[model samples]
Target: MTHWPDRPICAFDLETTDRDPRIARIVTASVVVLDGDTVASRTWLLDPGIEIPEETSAIHGVTTERARAEGLEYTAGYAQIREALCEAWVRDHIVVAFNASYDLTVIDAEGRRLGLPGLATGLVFDPYVVDREMDRGREGGRTLQAVCAAYGVTLTAAHQAEADALAAGQLARALCTRFPQLADLDIMTDQAAWHAERQRNFAEYLSGLGRDASDVDPQWPIRGIA
Candidate 1:
């Protein structure tokens, strides 16, 4: 059997309406399933049950009209996305998202709202979280682009969901190699625990930012490139 480090994994990314996974609809999603170090990829464009705002279209370039015309229906798209997430989990692949909390929570909430079950993917790797844990004493905290810069990983085609997924995967792999200790930590975190840790980190983080704040925690954890 392959080692955990070499195990099957899913590197995923989503482009959404907003940063809050609860309110944001997944406009597009991509999953790259990796066996060992080799990967096979899948991507979907979705009609998110709401009009795509002009600003969002400017970011990801998928207009509401275009999505409605060519993209899969919201229900069908969610079903397909859920199937991929569940399958990836059952196969023992880590559901890798650069910041997993927002995506997983969004998925869980969306499935429930749609009368479907939660993602069978029991675990997730937030490269951002993992990077923060590993590089706690380091400067320039763990944004995907910044982490990629620190690790010398190049990000191509910024704002494109599929490209962002691949780039995050590259950073995830590099981080694992650079800090093997993290792979040994318990990555099977529940939403509440993940949420708690993020809140704690942000509060501490904002103290560093010199911002006057009652609390630095935003209700949402997925910062950018949702």
Candidate 2:
């Protein structure tokens, strides 16, 4: 039997209007299924219902005009994205994301806005967090592109959702191979708890600096409703 880490996993990513997960509309999204080192399947969504700001479009290449002409309404577009992810979960595939917190939190906020079902936080694998925890203090940067280069994974089309999603999947596979701990099933089971501890630690550090820590959420993969 294939080890859990080497099996098919779901890699997801999103391109949005802005960085704030609470309000950004997803302009493009990709769900790429990876089996070990191979990409087995892929899905893409584009033209999310809102106006795409020029700055955002410059980054992701999806313009407001293109979105208005081809994209589904915001609610419907999100529904499609949600259904694809939920189905991946239902099939026992771990959803892999580069920086899972941001993507999942954004998805959660979008869910709240659309009245859609929220994602199960525990079913996620975040290469970014795992890398940071296991290989601390070794980096100049930790963005997806940075991490990919660190892992010797090539990431073409840096901000494009499908390319990013595919690269993230490759990064996960690479990390699992390099760090045996990441391949274990326990990573999935302990993800939420781990994030809680991480958040608490950061909150404490912030508290020492006189910053409020009460609002820091410990929710890992998917933040609770906005």
Choose the strongest candidate by TM-score. 2
Across 72-110, the per-residue lDDT of candidate 2 in tens digits comes to: 777777888888888887777879998787888888888
Pairs with steric clashes in candidate 2: none
Error of 2 at 32 (Å): 1.0
What residue runs in model 1 are displaced by over 4 Å at the alpha carbon?
189-195, 201-226
Of candidate 2, the 10-residue stretch with the lowest lDDT total is 36-45
Superposing all C-alpha atoms, what RMSD in Å does each candidate have to the true structure?
4.2, 2.4
lDDT values, one for every candidate: 0.74, 0.80
Spell out the clash pairs found in candidate 1. 14-226
Residue 142 C-alpha lDDT in model 2: 85
Q: How far is candidate 1 from the true structure (C-alpha RMSD, Å)?
A: 4.2
- Regions of candidate 2 where Cα sits further than 4 Å from its true position: 1-3, 36-45, 210-215
